[model samples]
Target: MADTPNGATPQQPAQVKMQVLAQYIRDLSFENIVAQKGTGGDVKPDVQVQVGLDAKKRTAENQYEVLSKYNITSKNKETGDVLFAMEVEYGGVFLIEGVPEQQLHPFLMIECPRMLFPFVRRIVSDMTRDGGFPALNLDTVDFMTIYRNEIERRQRESSAAQPTNA
Candidate 1:
């Protein structure tokens, strides 16, 4: 393993340190259909949003790529019609080094997502509020729980699909 520029030896054996290299809004799209209609002068708008997260290794190097995607929809309550739809994908490059093999999964699935989520949340909030809607601040996500659930689900599916040698 290469020594960190600080020259301090890793405290743990092959310790992994995740460094945020760069964070940016990769893509954003918003559409306001109701605003174009020029109607519903008194009706309040209802908004719903969904978010997703994904991570990938950039290369054999210590770099990682994290993606946070959001889908938001706004509707005019009175008309029961779509008002606006927005989608945004925020991404960042992270440097993970000296990580032990056993700890790599947790480091990538939990810690990395935790580190990247705040930036993604801010973008969604800002975009919604600035786009003439209320701020859509998201609640904290339990990535560990999500990861475990995903693993369990996959395992169950795989086991169910396999044939037992009777």
Candidate 2:
């Protein structure tokens, strides 16, 4: 390796280009078959939601797969009946390269997710409210925490299954 004037290897600048080639809700489902009977005359409704994030390598060089999925179930507690069930999957392909290893996780978790979230959020809110129920608003997620937890979980599982000698 060539050394700089200071006798240390020169660090390469990161080359990162983040662009949203396309943004849309990939899949959406809303089930309100029982809304009429459950709400007991179009009463107020409550919704509970869960969100998850996942990433994978795409076929193209330096391309990535990022997905944000939400599962929401709305109910009328007083009647102990279901109001609506919705599931949505939002995903995008990101092109990135030359980014430092330390910054890669943040780029995917924070920056990429931020780009895709608004579209997803709108779908959830619009669909629920339009379906004759209160809007379903989701809280923002901390992608870094989710990414780190996933890594740690995988490591723990692998370590547990491996032989001690190996």
Candidate 3:
């Protein structure tokens, strides 16, 4: 450790602490379109998944809430008919400390959701299995990549919204 000119040692960063206070499913919906419409023989399905993330500061000190939303759709590959559609919004209340102010947003958006992903995956798998389809195990999400893409998207939107001085 290097000492400053005043002979004081550099201060070490505070240890980061994170705890999950609570987790819940905010909303969920599943529709079996194939059952309603009755698909013909040899139905091959194609699945698509979309995910969204949001975070908010709670009123309590050092508390935050994060939400992960998933939209899943399955269609028959040959006929282009909808087989199933599902949406799930899961939330987690977290107690977080020691992270710097400049890093809180990223931490909340990325780390918090990463922590809550397992529960979300389980819920999705259960819901699918209970809804009459084979269990759907979601692939692991890359929160860092998602965060970078979101930042780039916001920058592009902000720049496009700006007025040209010319």
Candidate 4:
């Protein structure tokens, strides 16, 4: 807002802004640990995908780097043979401005990762398909639940590590 008629800043009206400054794949690896059996016939493999989130402050002001890590394992449940395994750490640099300090952590953990997930998911699907397996379609992630779980886990750990009165 243009300075008040009398030249006062007016607190900037509490603008809340968040933006993705840049995004990239920090690490990506696909491993076929064991040979995929079956001679060009219909195969049903059990696929397991694990997703994790991590974030750290960047050197620039109001910038942060958040990594969405994924570990996927595909196997034949009947034979317990590993068909394929993939690990990717996709990262995004976010510019967070005008948000309260209390809200910043959640913004980075939940919102930032949520924004970057689709691209990472697409890459994973493409990688799996390129590796001679059926494309692995991923479902939407529930980041809020993950965030809450992490908070609870950390709280429990903090309490467990503290010394009790003798």
Off by over 4 Å in 1: 1-12, 37-47, 75-80, 164-166
In candidate 2 the C-alpha lDDT for residue 138 amounts to 74
lDDT of 1 by residue, 21-51 (tens): 9888889998767567766467677777676
Please give each candidate's TM-score.
0.74, 0.76, 0.93, 0.85
Query: Each prediction's Cα RMSD?
Result: 6.4, 4.0, 1.6, 3.6
**lDDT scores of the candidates, listed in order:** 0.79, 0.78, 0.93, 0.87
State the displacement of the C-alpha of residue 97, model 4, in Å, after optimal TM-score superposition: 0.8
Q: Between prediction 1 and prediction 3, which has the larger lDDT?
A: 3
User: Clash number for model 1?
Assistant: 1
Runs of candidate 2 exceeding 4 Å displacement: 1-12, 41-46, 78-80, 101-106, 163-166
lDDT of 4 by residue, 29-83 (tens): 9976555443344456898888899999999999999999999998777766778
Candidate 4 stretches with Cα past 4 Å from truth are 1-13, 34-42
Residue pairs of candidate 3 with colliding backbone atoms: none
Report the CA-based lDDT of candidate 3 relative to the real structure: 0.93
**How would you encode candidate 2's per-residue C-alpha lDDT over 2-60 as one tens digit per residue?**
99998999877766777666566778898885755543475445678777777777788
Model 1 residue 21 lDDT score: 92
Name the weakest run of 10 consecutive residues (lDDT summed) in model 3: 34-43
Top candidate on lDDT is: 3
Candidate 1 Cα deviation (angstroms), residue 84: 3.1
